[model samples]
Target: MRRYGPAVLLLLTGAAILRISLLSELYLRYVQAGLRPYLVVSGFLLVLLGVAAAVAGRREQEPHGAHGGHHAPRIAWLLALPALALLLFPPPALGSYSAGREAAQRAAQGVGAFPALPAGGPVALTLAEFSSRAIYDSGRSLTGRTVRLTGFVTRDDDGTWYVTRLLVSCCAADATTNKVEIRGADAPPADAWVTVTGTWHPKGSLGTDGAWPPVLDAASVRRVAQPANPYERR
Candidate 1:
């Protein structure tokens, strides 16, 4: 058991990775969809390495120690705990706590014209696009059009609440929050996913702090299941 500690740890870790990336879509919670292939390859390699190491260990003679064979450090087994935990219970996607911790950072794009929205009412848009157009678009494309947005609910200390989503460039570690303050509808439980349908409520002039968060006069808030890939890409 002592001589096989490293190989066991490697096998467990690799199995955990494969469980998340190859067996299920759970990997989407932490990484971009495009990286799935890479994760699969890495996990396969790790499993292969673990098998090779175990075979090599078995062939090699173990030096005799006071007990019998050389003993591995007790701490070596601790490394397996995380892999086991991940295998059995993977972490949930970043949610309200993550969104609330982020500071409001408006996009760097200057106030400018946005392409005309497709002719329609209740256009479906990502929170990032909605925030960008609401805060920086001089055209005010969202002014009269009803739009639909989906995100998890997050509340402020003052009873104010938002429909928030995290934007990620590569992985969960780089996630940033993009949220819109809800005006009319009562907020669902914190971290509950919802689809908000409403018209934009204009605030201060575009591109100012006052315009931040971009209010939405929600007409209807419907509870929805969290998406498989919750994070919006940059």
Candidate 2:
């Protein structure tokens, strides 16, 4: 039992992170939806490890001997830190602070041609999808189509305004941003979520290795609540 004390702490620590990730949607801040299965499996494995260690320790008991000497107390105490931090203060989702530091990462197109847009006046698309077409497809597919996009606002010191969203390759640490330069309206306050209706501005051009985000000739802008899933996974 005593030999497995640290294992128990490890189990709780892993489980606590998983619990917060699932129940509180804290996982959204750190990883893609695809990783949920791996996280679940890992949490269960930690619990099983602790249970096995506890059972084995019980069977190996020396009636008069201490299961674990005092030296291990510090290790067990240290193992509890992450678990305690998770319980006390859940980590905040990536916000303006993170978004502000990111660079322009929009592309002209993705791997292949975009699927046909709805046969109508305008097609609503994600900031990522719109930017991809703007940068990669040579303005062929989106030459005259109107697009509606929803994302948070970001304004530069030079007065440039952008409708922006984050795209995470794997985790927050690996997050890239998708931004559409709003051509007309004065940008709202930073991080204010909004939906914009716009046309692609061809002047943005086929993106070079490090070109800035394409521009959108915005027709209208509407305020919206921030979405539950803020990052686009690719």
Candidate 3:
């Protein structure tokens, strides 16, 4: 335990940093709708565990000289579980679950701004990427071409399903949900991962003031599952 203390502490610290980073302002706005409470709880737990690990490291008994005692290497292996879990079953992406909640919030405030996409190429973007670009271009840049996207299903509403990709600045707590509307695909189970191939059509009438009115007319949709690391980097 003593020999592995530093590594454990480092892991905990790294996790904490990740969580805090995801909870930043831009990301937090969307994450708050569905995950704020859970994140708060998780944050508290992480803090407590971090403190416990620090205290334990300080209280541990010192090892004797090499001739007297050799530290056991087995304790270092204990960290494998968490490392494996993160590698294998990373938490699901923010999908349909956050759609309605976020949409409602955005509606109340009016749709936010978006940027224009550059000319001459199919934009390969995540929901977050498109959203950020939309802020600057308002869908003007993506008017007539296909945009490829991938994300998890968050939830479904009346006749409309919302797909989302999580953009995390640090960790889940700071993660933000970027949403896209699927107009005519078979609805997959909520939280299922998927890739969407479609064209962006400006929703001329449905857009909020200063926001681009556009929806993805999905040509094909395929379901998958969350990846090892679920967050999109800034």
Candidate 4:
């Protein structure tokens, strides 16, 4: 246990970071409301416990026959599996996998308005940034101009693919799903991260039954890999 103790502690620390960063959004969406607080508290405890275990293990190594064996702690390495899982299979982005989920309950309210752009320059914004700004300003400022955006793939009704970005407040637990319509030659694979340069055009008068209005008419689509920092905004 002593030999692997530091490795176990590192794994726990990495898991804690992932839990706070990427996976929080999934937990917020799928987990029951009542259990959220407990999950958070437990995550905090895990971090503390990992730190304590590491420290204790180091102290124990100083004393001979602490574990009544000649070998160092072997069991400590077993703790690394969960952290490895998190690194390998991160929670899915808030896309079609989560479309059927309740939007109002899951989406963040009032993300605040985007800053006004200077006259005559291409507008660059993430799906979340555009959505928050559009909500506040009614898309008045975004009309009739080329825009640059990036995100993974999501599809809308009528078989149109969107370049979507997830706005996460915490892990996958509290993620806001937003997407922009991608229009151009060559459809990219679902969930492939891409940078799109396009024109932002209104799809005309919010679709029936209050659907999201307007989509970007993509001028260019360049496929890219999942970024090191996957979330769109902080």
Candidate 3, residues 1-234: lDDT per residue as tens digits?
Answer: 554465564555445434533443222423433455665566556656767777777777766665433344455555656644543444434555544454321222333445555565556786756654444453356667778788777554475675676666555565555677777787787778888888875554434434432368888898765654455665
Query: Model 4, 1-234: lDDT tens per residue?
Result: 455466476646556544744465444433433456666667666677767767666766476556574443455565666666654554544555553352532234543335566677567776766654454444366767677887787664567887776666555556666776666646677767788888766554431213353467777888887665566544
Error of 1 at 99 (Å): 1.0
- In order of appearance, the predictions have TM-scores of 0.96, 0.76, 0.51, 0.58
lDDT of each: 0.92, 0.75, 0.58, 0.60
Better of 1 and 4 by TM-score: 1
Which stretches in model 3 have alpha-carbon errors above 4 Å? 1-122, 135-139, 204-214
lDDT of 2 by residue, 124-158 (tens): 88877776776676436887888898988888789
Per-residue CA lDDT of candidate 1, range 2-88, in tens? Answer: 768878888999999999999999999999999999999989988998999899889889776657433355777888999999999
From the highest TM-score down, the ranking of the candidates is 1, 2, 4, 3
Maximum-lDDT candidate: 1
- Over 4 Å off, model 4: 1-80, 84-115, 133-139, 156-158, 204-213
Give the lowest summed-lDDT range of ten residues in model 4: 204-213
Better of 2 and 4 by lDDT: 2
Q: Candidate 1: which pairs clash? A: none
Clash count for each candidate, listed in order shown:
0, 4, 25, 18
